[model samples]
Target: MFKTKWFSGGFSGGFSGKLSGKLSGKLSGKLSGKLSGAALAGLLTAAGAAQAASVSFVQPTDGATVSNPVHVVFALDGMKVAPAGTMMDGTGHHHLLVDGKPLAKGEVIPANDKSLHFGKGQTETDLTLPPGDHTLTLQFGDGAHRSYGPELSKTITVHVK
Candidate 1:
């Protein structure tokens, strides 16, 4: 069982300073094997892609049904978030995918066209989606909007009504 909690506290000029992220839960030996299996699956999913920062939604579950103006939370592992021009290697911002294919590795993901980029290390946001089913994915990109790579993203499904 993997349990997690998210809270917001300090922000410098609308950019998140630190995230009070907490993870609790026990992974049985069997569960550990499962995690490794899942990791392998992800690697297989992106057979040939650039390295992108991995992200996950802390507020909503995949295929969750919710109202518009949804709150989305982003999480990144093995990277740091910085300004657009100050991004460092293995660190970057988050991009919200509305309904599109996964971005190619190293390809610069545009902030426009249903894509949302948080280059200032923003951790949360309220999004208003039109009533419909949408695929939500978090792609962490460098200062240049290039994907951290193919293995660092989290994809989920959400329905707005």
Candidate 2:
């Protein structure tokens, strides 16, 4: 039987299994029922924090003026870029959040015109933006498209001429 003691907004017992490292408190017991949403969230957060990673723009220096069809390049450190659906530790693909804010932790990064997905492990891309000022955020997401949070993201501002 799996026993879990619920403390104030945390677990204070023991659970045996893969969740041992994800939880805040100690876990000791046989695997049991499904984990609650909170537990799953905690696990995801812990997983995201396991590595120290960073993403940045390699081209179009910040605050630079550019023309249409802007060329964008992405750089990553402390992790490997892998295609989506490839679940490997210290690996993930890049996402270009064009003029958008960072996605919440464990949140699924949306796919749209602004939110570009590099599921194929692309390191760079070309974007066409209207004449104006825009922000480009480079975010890295896990194989499942779950965001690694802002800690793994880089934002830059550019002016289109």
Candidate 3:
């Protein structure tokens, strides 16, 4: 990692890792999508924190209001989605933590209703929840279902009417 950075080191220090990741992801996303106006603004406004991987909501966007059986979508950047037990670098699966918090790195995401695992590499689902305010966390996990840490996750709020 250090040697690779030294070669493409745009800026120096630890900041380079974060800056490069963010800049690369942004540039690639922009060049591929070619978005403009509000759409570009929306992409810029999306909350992302992963240095090498990012998992976030694609549908029912953050702070969206909706009904039960919400149309949920998952988006990933800088990483590839694979089925559980694949055990490959830069690859993992998504997990929807409904009304749950982000798990620590290497921590096993519990098996329960709140923690919905997408071991088959699912990117979207129709989530049925009670009518009320809820917090949704999009988490990524390795083949063993161990979390990739908070940086690889995103949390959003939704109001069910």
Clashes of each: 8, 4, 1
lDDT of 3 at 128: 71
List ranges where model 3 is wrong by over 4 Å: 1-51
- Where does the lowest 10-residue lDDT sum fall in candidate 2? 4-13
After superposing candidate 1 on the true structure, give the runs of residues whose Cα lies further than 4 Å from its correct spot. 1-53
Question: Native-vs-model 3 lDDT?
Answer: 0.72
- Estimate, for each residue in 1-161, the C-alpha lDDT of model 1 and write its tens digit: 11122224222221122222221123332344666533533443344322333567887899899886688887664355666676444456777777766677898887675787776667777777778888888887778889765576788889888
Question: Scored by CA lDDT, what does every candidate get?
Answer: 0.63, 0.71, 0.72
TM-score of each: 0.65, 0.68, 0.69
Worst window of 10 by summed lDDT in candidate 1: 15-24
Model 3 weakest 10-residue run by lDDT = 1-10
Off by over 4 Å in 2: 1-51
RMSD of 1: 12.3
For candidate 1, the per-residue lDDT at 91 reads 52
